[model samples]
Target: MLNVLVTGGNGQLGCEIREVAPEFADKLRLFFVTRENLNLESESEIETFISANQIQAIVNTAAYTAVDLAEKEPEKARSSNVVIPKLLAKIANRHKIKMLHVSTDFAFDGKSGKPYKEDDLTSPISIYGKTKEEGEREVLKELPKAIILRTSWVYSKYGNNFLKTIRRLGKERPELKIIYDQIGTPTWARDLARVILKMIQTKDLSGFYHYSNEGIASWYDFAKEILDLSNLKTKILPIETSEYPTPATRPTYSVLNKKKIKQTLEIEIPHWKDSLKVCLSELD
Candidate 1:
């Protein structure tokens, strides 16, 4: 059996991986570690764990995901997103193990009129995005074979995401104003988790790739669908991004092109709406 180590065991993608891990139990031996159990920021600790367990592969899901909060805490963001990935890449290279790192679409400036491909130029606008972009660079530099999976607008039943936020607020508020201009696809974390597990098991699979649900939607559109799925009566008013200004500027259009991953893995991607329905059902 292939021994695999999954960091960030408590986050959305990590939690989803845990939920679906039993399906792959026959072929994979998965060990999960969160901040409570493993100090990911500590280099010696990570190195020791990987060596002690003889880990064959690693799925690095840990990240500093607070977008707006990152603006004020750039040091913390760099520590989590940059330094940790760099360290992990170095260790994985030494251990000669496969590594898959999760990244975000915010790596782009969102000025592209078309969907972003794996090779597109990245011009990050915020601290979080910049740090993520830097982290990707570090991983690639340290281990060129490491897989960098970039995704957008991730949500799940386990974490604080747009879907959960809208669901909670839609229940309490009569009306919610959501940004409609900024557009991207909503990715269910469970889908991404499954894809990562599959990728880890497949050998000689490395480099940059993109994955998200097939369809696109703005924040307002996503919120509307969530409220509808939850059977909530809260009215959602569509507003421009300027109307609801945030500390970190979001991409006006950050939809990722999934053609590379689709063709490479031959995996079918569910539409955002369809996956949203399934996720809402799980939440219920």
Candidate 2:
């Protein structure tokens, strides 16, 4: 079996990968490492692990994802979001290991009226976005073969996400207010994990691609769907982004263009609602 090293083993994406890994057992031997076990900063540690496991591939799910908090603590975010990926990319390249690095839609300012393409100009408005963009640059420079997947509005049953948070809040509150101004697709981590496995199995090496669920929605729309599907009685109110200010400014539209991934990979993507239902069903 080919050994694959997955970072951020404790995160939602990482956890989802673990859940789906059994299906790929015949081809892959995945070593999911949480931060406690795998320190990304130390080169010696990364090298030691890669050498010990004879890791042939690396799936870098680890990243600093707190958008608002990143604005306040740019240094910590930079180290985790930018430096860690860069270091890992360099190591992966040195060892000639296949690498897949996850990025976010925040890399865009959401200025594009249409969905964002892989070649679109990146103008990050927040520190988190800037750091993530920089990380992408470093990884590409160091390891051109590395597959970089940029995703948006990811939620999963495994970790603390919008769906989980809204479920809890709806149980407690009769009404919920969600931002209607910001629009994007809500990506389910399970779907993403499955796609990553496909990429690994097929040995598809597209340099840059955007992966998110089909269709578009605002935060308010997403909230209503969540409550409706979960059979919660909470009433949802539509509010503008101005009403809910955060340290990091979100894009008014960050929908990723899926044509590249769809065309290149020849894979079918599930509709956001269909995948949402499956996730909710699993959650129950």
Candidate 3:
């Protein structure tokens, strides 16, 4: 069996990976580590962990994802998104092991009227996006064979995500206003987790790829779907981006085209509405 180390063990994606690990038990022995368990800041510590566990692959999912907070803490964001990926890539290269790094669709400025493809040029507008983009470059510089997966609007039953937040607010308030200007796909963490596992098994699969649940929706549509699925009586009101301001500027449109990954993996992706239903069912 291949020994695989998964970072961000407590995050939504990591949790979903943990849930589905048993299905790949015959081929993969997955080791999950959170910051509490592993000192990611120290290179020696990560090197020692890899050597000790005989790890053959590394999935780096731990990232400084506090988008608005990142603006105030650029250094911290750089450390997590850029420095850490470079360190892991360096170590993985030394060990000649497979590595998969997760990234965000915010890498783009979102001015692209069309869906972004794998080769689209990235012009990040926020500190969080810039750091993530830099991290992708750092990994590629260290380990040319490492795979990078960029996804958008990730949510799960675990963690404080949009879906969960909507569910909570919908229960407490009868009326809610959400952003309708920004658009992207809502990716189920479970779906992304399954795709990651598949990529791990595919030989010579390395480079940047995009993955998200099929179809697209604005935040308002996403919130409406969640309330509808949960049978909540909350009324959702659509508002423009100007109405709700954040420290970080979000792309008006950040939908990623999944044709490359779909063709490469030969798998059909689930639509956002369908995946939303599946994820909501799990929450029930």
Please report, in order, the local distance difference test score of every candidate based on alpha carbons.
0.94, 0.92, 0.95
Distance from true location, Cα of 144 in model 2, Å:
1.4
**lDDT, candidate 1, residue 177?**
95
Clashes of each: 0, 0, 0
TM-score-better candidate, 1 vs 2: 1
* Tens-digit per-residue lDDT, 1-284, candidate 3: 88999999999999999989988999999999999999888989998999999999999999999999999999999999999999999999999999999999999999997889989999999999999999999999999999999999999998889999999999999899999999999999999999999898789999999999999999999999999989999988999999999999989999999999999999999999999998888889
| Candidate 3: segments with Cα more than 4 A from true spot | none
TM-scores of the models, in the order given: 0.99, 0.98, 0.99
What overall lDDT, based on C-alpha atoms, would model 1 receive against the true structure?
0.94
- Pull out the clashing pairs in model 3: none
Candidate 2 lDDT over residue span 191-220, tens digit each: 999888777656648488999999999989
- Judge candidate 1 at residue 144 and give its lDDT: 95
> What count of clashes does model 1 give?
0
What stretches of model 2 exceed 4 Å from their correct place?
A: none
